[model samples]
Target: MEFTEYGFPPDYLDEISSAVQKNDIRDLIEEGLIKAKPIKGTSRARARKADAQRAKGRRKGQGSRREAPTRGTPRSTAG
Candidate 1:
């Protein structure tokens, strides 16, 4: 309904949606909506790219590095 990336249906959605309960993800999963499989993430590729970029003098700024220490951190809640 909101039509975000995860919310909106993809290209092959019609075939799957035709069978499952309309607009309901739970029902679709419960009824086994065309055997959807989880795909592996590209985090490794992204890490490699970041490494390459950093090697080329990118993402080495103050924003990239940790500006503060965990031990010397500020406490949000007073105990």
Candidate 2:
């Protein structure tokens, strides 16, 4: 049976296989096909750093400049 029969998104099959090969069972559990006991030793810091790097890479590839904040008349500070 295809993975989609088990309620998983079909497009994620390759990613799921790669995660299994890398010993990342947590990802499978998160996908909700089976219950998994929690495992220790995963690097949370490294995950955050990797995510930041990916975001930076995406922004660099897009090559779009961020718009500067607009300037307008200052509003009264009083409520």
Name the candidate that leads on TM-score.
1
Q: Once superposed on the true structure, which residue ranges of model 2 sit more than 4 Å away at CA?
A: 1-3, 21-23, 31-79
Show the colliding residue pairs in model 2: none
TM-score of each: 0.31, 0.27
In model 1, what is the error at residue 29, expressed in angstroms?
24
- Estimate, for each residue in 1-79, the C-alpha lDDT of model 2 and write its tens digit: 2345445557666766677443476657665643434456767997798779878875443245444333232556323
Q: Hey, what RMSD does candidate 1 come out at?
A: 12.3
The Cα local distance difference test for each model comes to: 0.60, 0.57
Which regions in candidate 1 have their CA more than 4 angstroms from the true location?
Answer: 1-42, 67-79
TM-score of candidate 1 versus the correct structure, residues matched by position: 0.31
Candidate 2 is scored at a TM of: 0.27
